[model samples]
Target: MLACLLLAQLLVAFIGRSVGPLGVLIGEDLELSKSQIGMLPAALFLGQAIASIPVGFVVDQTGSKTLLLLISLCVGSSFILMTFSHQFGFVLFLVVIGGLGYGAMHPVTNRGIIHWFQRTQRGFAMGIKQTGITTGSALAGLVLLPLAAMYGWRQVVAAACLLLIMGGVVSYTFYHDSIKETNQDKKNLASFYGSMKHMVRNKPLMLVSISAMGLSGSQLCLVTYIVIYCYEYLDISLFLSGVLLVISEICGSIGRIVWGIISDRLFKGKRVIILMIISGIAGVTSMILAFLPPSTTFGVMIPITMVFGFAISGFNAIWMNVASEVVDTTFSGLSSGFSITLGSLGVITLPPLFGFIVDFFGSFTAGWIMIVGVMILVFMLLLLLLLEIKTRAAY
Candidate 1:
């Protein structure tokens, strides 16, 4: 069941990022500027951000299994709709609606995982589950560009619609909810509202949400720009750049699993501490990459990017673990969703802003510096969060 949920999320991520790998071709087809090309992802994040809170609330009220099936259908249908779009505006609209389905996955799927896994096993489980994003994105990076090159980008999207439908079918056929819990959830209509109020008032959850904004923003910039950055800055071939991006995602997939084990065993589930350490690593790596000259070999950059991938990509499941730790079970979905909503601001704004910086400065350096600034902020907040926890513990 967890695997099915993960597969569904992986497919959703593939759909969410469908525009990115093919950005160059899509841009040429639509006659778009760099900033406009960047807006494609921004629009998807925007739609997901808009839907996050409401979907979180819904997840708390209903069964995640049902929501997963429904959202999968929505996502699959949106991809089918996207193939018919002739204008950028229309594509953007479909992406936004598709994003609503994407938004539902985190809250619904994470809650479902939390329901089944014990606390001792959950970090690892969540880690494995979160890999769907990097794995799917990685697969898309490796597969989509070549397909677009051979068959045209529109046809690739049409093919994606079929895969997404399979995800929906798998979710409906195999995924099961806890019937007793679902019945209990229906009995407490007021608890759903109470959960919302609780999440807003919870200081730890709010801090995690704010931390997520920085982490997510920095990570989004990496995912959105790395291919183009390699093409324009390093003069790498588009196909090779896509391969490098795939390597990063594959490394990240491994990191997610490894970090989960470490958090569960070495740290004894001290996820926030792990988050702080990784944030520092991610910050330093971003700064290093930012200042690298065009002459730097891809060999050097590859290992550095692999490290960046390890640091940034590993903590996603940990953040959810941290959120689930702090909140009650009844509000777990709400807390996770709320944090993602706050975090989506980074995804929504950063890509275009990075592109604008690139356009204005005519280089990738300043945009990476922007990411470094966010990482610094993230580190400080995590430090403060840790200190506050210590102070409360001492009291």
Candidate 2:
């Protein structure tokens, strides 16, 4: 099941990350300003945001395996449609479609993995799955950039679609999860609301929501801008930038699986406090390096940034894990749905916010500062959860 989840992760990454490379092509060919380039990313996130609530309900009604197969097709077709997108508006439309397809994975995939893996092994299980994002990013970095460089932009888009189709076929054939019996306690809508309201009223779901917001927002911010940042700020080649993203993602992928295993073994499957410390360290470390004087040495900045990526996703994988512990299993779909939906707001708001900052201030460094600032809560929340974990009754 972990192996299968890992493949889904790989496919999700492959399908989702073409935007960065696409943004580069669109900017050059379309004569876009930094602000204009944001439209595609903003569109993608917006699509994801739009579908966020709906996908959760879908997962609850059907099952994740079913949702995954459907999403793969939807997202794959969105990629195929992308090949015809010559104008900004056309691309914008496809971006939304692609984003919606991408967003479906979280609610569907997160719960499915939780259902598949036991508590003791979930960190590593989900970690291995998270590697799919990095793997896709790395593949895109290596393949998409060069395809755009040599064959032109359309080929790059076409290639992403091809990968998604293959993954979809595999998913349809192999991935299956028996529908869980809805809990006797969860039979009523009132009980469901009461359960979540309890989390909202008594626990730190809101705090976890804030953490998710920061992590998701900051990660997308980097994904949106890193290619442009490298070209504009670092004076590196596109191929080199792509390769760096791939390498960092590879490291991040390893970090996710390894950290999951570590958090479980060392902390005995209590995840919150452990990921918080890691996030804080990653946040601070990445901030320090982003400020260093720009030089050829800046080529090394990606690995530095990737440490933060590893930590952010580490905590992200577990937020739902912990939430599942707090809520009843019958409603894990709804809990994950709510968490991912609200968390997506960060992605929607931050990219354009950072874009405006760069447009006005004319410094990517300040944008980096804004991105790293999200980690401040990592320290605070970690301490909070650490204390909460001691009581084991906070949820």
Best by TM-score: 1
Steric clashes per prediction: 0, 2
TM-score of each: 0.96, 0.89
Candidate 1 residue-wise lDDT, 1-395, digit = tens: 78888988898888777667777778878898878888887887787788887787777777677887788888778868888888999988988888888888888888887888888899999999999988877888899877887898888977887888788788878888765347653525576667677888888888888999888777777777888888888888888888877887888888888889999999887788889988998989889989988987778778988988888876788988888778878777777888888988988888889889989998889989988898889999998888777776699
TM-score, model 1 to reference:
0.96
Scored by lDDT, the top model is: 1
Error of 2 at 77 (Å): 1.3
Tens digit of lDDT per residue, candidate 2, span 301-344? 76675675566544556666665555666666666767677677
lDDT of each: 0.83, 0.70
